[model samples]
Target: MILYIKYMVSLRCKMMVEQELKNIGLHYVVVELGSVEILEDITLEQREALKRNLLKSGLELLDDKRSILIEKIKNVIVEMIHYQDELPKTNYSDYIAEKLGYDYTYISNIFSEVKGINIQQFIIHHKIEKVKELLLYGDLNLTEISYKLHYSSVAHLSNQFKKVTGLTPTFYKKLRRKRDDNLENI
Candidate 1:
């Protein structure tokens, strides 16, 4: 049986889901970001127990088609931005549509209706968040970060960063370092 889960965003959420499945003695074949497949079909009691357990940790099993589709879209973007080292050479809309096996226009319309924002907006948001994380790590300079994140140039990255964060990446990095220094002193 395949079960779709909502709000399974991070590694911690995946771990919690895995632990819950183990606790219930289910032999899961796979547990990816937003879905799981088990070797055995689950009983209603097992399903309810799993749902209840997951709810306690701010996750829910998605049964509705629309919700499941939405989660799949999110999972694809999340996997691309957070997990993959390099983005696709093609346009994101084309990549996403091809990957999901759906028409881009239909996907965009449904996503906008469900999410109250366009898919591009979601991608930009995730990209910005990833940029923030990379900046915090301080392993790469601005130009490298821009290239890694698929930004056209350092200036474009800086403009988007400033537009979203109200501060440049350099300032944001310095602010984080100062805050960490203060915490260490405390």
Candidate 2:
């Protein structure tokens, strides 16, 4: 059985999910960002138990199909922007459509309807959040940060950063304070 989870974003989340499965004597074949596959079918009682346990730990077992699909979209974007070292050369819309096995129009429409924001805005929000993270790490220069985030140039990155943050990247970095939207909220 494949179970879609909410807020399974980090490595720690993966570990917690694995532990929960083990504690409940469920054998999982795989656990990857927002979803898991188990070796055996789960009973309703077991499913409820899992859901309750997850909720207690600030996680959720997604039941609604639309919510599941939305999480899948979020997972794909999160992996691309925050985890992956490189993005595809093709446009993000094409890449996302291909990766999700859905038409770009459908995905975009559904995402917008459910999230109350367009896909492009969501991507920009994530990209800016990533820039904040990279800046906080204090390892990459602005030029390198722009390249890593697939921005056209440092000027473009700075402009977007300022637009979203109301401060230049340099000033934001210098302040060493966090100012960005939460991933789950976005």
Candidate 3:
């Protein structure tokens, strides 16, 4: 049996789902970001109990096919943007379509309809967030960050960063450092 879960994006979420499965005496084959496979089929009663337990921990079990597909799309992008060590070599639309085994047009339409933003916009948002994280870490320079994130150039990165955040990358880094220093002083 396979179960799709919403809001199961982080490692912590995977752990919580695994623990819940154990508590319910269910043996799971694998627990990925947004879905799990169980060794044995589950019962209706078990499903309801599991749903309630997951809800208590801010997760929801997805039953609708459309909702499941949406979650899968989100999980794939989140994993790529936030967790992967290197960006994909191919373009994002092709990557997403190939990964999800659907037509790019269909996926884009569904994602836009459900998320109220185009898939490309969603990817840009996640990429910017990742850039913010790397900048705050202070280990990577703007050039290195751009290269790693597959940007064409540092100028491009700076432009997108400014466009999305209304502040340049250097300014954002300085602001984060200032906030950290203030917290340490207190």
Find the candidate with the highest lDDT and give its number: 3
lDDT of residue 66 for candidate 2: 91
- TM-score for model 3? 0.96
Pitting candidate 1 against candidate 2, the one with the higher TM-score is 1
lDDT winner between candidates 2 and 3: 3
Total backbone clashes of model 1?
Answer: 0
Q: State each model's CA lDDT, in order.
A: 0.93, 0.91, 0.94
Error of 2 at 33 (Å): 0.4
Q: Give the clashing pairs for model 1.
A: none
After superposition, which runs of candidate 3 have C-alpha atoms over 4 Å from their true positions?
none
lDDT of 3 by residue, 81-154 (tens): 99999989999999999999999999899989998999989899899999999998759999999999999999
TM-scores for all predictions: 0.96, 0.92, 0.96
The candidate with the higher TM-score, 2 or 3, is 3
Count of backbone collisions within predicted model 2? 0
lDDT of 1 by residue, 1-186 (tens): 889999998889989999999999898888999999999999898899999999999999988998998998999999999989888888999999998899999888999999999999999889989999999975899999999888999999999999888999899999999999999998
Candidate numbers, best TM-score first, in rank order: 3, 1, 2
